[model samples]
Target: EGMDVVSFASSAGPNNQQVITEQQLSTLFSNVEEILEANQKFLLSLRQLGFEWTNNPQHLGEAIKKHIPPLKKSYMTYATNFYHAQVFLLSLLEETKPGPLMSYITRWEKEVIKIDMSPLLSYLILP
Candidate 1:
């Protein structure tokens, strides 16, 4: 459990680039569930972090760094695991074909198809 958890997160993201992690680490430190649940420790951790997203949370990284230091080590492991779990859940739903979450995911897919990506083409498109 004490296995340099952030390193794992650093290794598992897109391009194995730890896209979930950053130099300042504002996002991952903000959620205990994101740190623990992703590491397969869901039952041992709190289900929520008791914080809410506001338009501006004010020095949020400072607050998170102060408060969440105890749980910040393993965010990537948690995120990777959580992503796998969601994929598994979605596939399970797909095989059975139809449920509340499945319906929501389907709706999201429909909405995504309507997005206009042309604006980002210059910066995001690969040569």
Candidate 2:
């Protein structure tokens, strides 16, 4: 009986942790103005060509054919950071208690269901 109680208590810790972390994430995501602003900035940066726009595709291709390096280094850096943030958020969710986490999920699901987000969903799943 003592061993059973200890195991139950240990299991309860992870559930509590997951709930707290999920609440934290939900609160963080709740500010729509800031989220929209950051998203707009990210899209604007992607659309900007900088110096690369001036290059002729055929000529640039031929010139760098033998010694080409990867492009979009900055974009890749940002993508890596974004992926890390998602993973961190998920980890926090897993660490939070189940009850509060469930409540957050319920709220978030309602908000998400109300949004018309085909474009945003595509971007979220992009490589």
Candidate 3:
């Protein structure tokens, strides 16, 4: 519960400054981790299917049996939720950058957080 993932933890700002609430930051990662787990499971199921690009009925049928509807649902779920989270985090980073709170954020944080914005990239690398 004392993890240092909070963006404000490393800041050089005044100890009394209030930039982002702990609940806001925690909730963002909580939602992200939740969607990440759900989407990883779905993506892994596709990877595990191991069907080639053949036109055979059996192979195609196996793919179809894997349920495309739910896959699409999961994809959309991840896409929309992640988009909102990314927008919020990006705005937060920018809003804090010119202020004393910016000192609390490291350059690594700015660079690495950009990677968190893409959900599709996760599908490609998760397996």
Candidate 4:
């Protein structure tokens, strides 16, 4: 995608060309929605597991370790979807008239980073 964008940009003259169309925008939006839905599902699954273990740490730790593979898989899936969404959004920003994308970029830049639990859970479960 980056190579395609670079080739397109190089071929163009001084003035910017409208490379993105309404159809492309629609498709990107749909892709973003799908990514969001998947993220929500992953988060919901994690929350459910957390809730289930709230009363019993030992049992919860065991369950988490037993389920590590699925949790890691889901986390990786979510991360990939998130990266795709970011790329799509960045492409849209460069190809279309700017609007809220800048705000989103700003907000994202300001957001704090936290530890991911997929790897952390194993250490946490160790006695």
- Give lDDT tens digits, candidate 2, residues 16-115: 5533344444332322333444555554544553456467455444434422222244334445555554554466456655464445544554666678
Q: What is the lDDT of every predicted structure here?
A: 0.40, 0.42, 0.50, 0.45
Candidate 3 per-residue lDDT, tens place, 1-127, comes to 2234444543334766665565655433434444445556656766765655354457556655666665565555555556555555556656733554344444545555687754322322221
Off by over 4 Å in 1: 1-77, 116-127
Candidate 3, residue 55: how far the Cα is off, in Å:
8.6
Candidate number with greatest lDDT: 3
The full ranking of all candidates by lDDT, starting with the best, is 3, 4, 2, 1
Q: Which candidate model has the greater lDDT, 3 or 4?
A: 3
Task: Point out the higher-scoring one by lDDT: 1 or 3.
Answer: 3
State the RMSD for candidate 3: 7.9
Kindly list the per-residue Cα lDDT of model 4 for residues 1-127, writing each as its tens digit: 3123223323433345544455444333323334444555656656777766667777667655666665556545545555444566556546555534334433433442233323311221211
lDDT of 1: 0.40
For model 2 the local lDDT of residue 74 reads 33
Alpha-carbon shift of residue 5 in model 4 (angstroms): 25
Error of 4 at 20 (Å): 12
TM-score of 3: 0.39
Give candidate 2 regions above 4 Å deviation: 1-73, 98-109, 116-127
Worst 10 residues of 1 by lDDT: 118-127
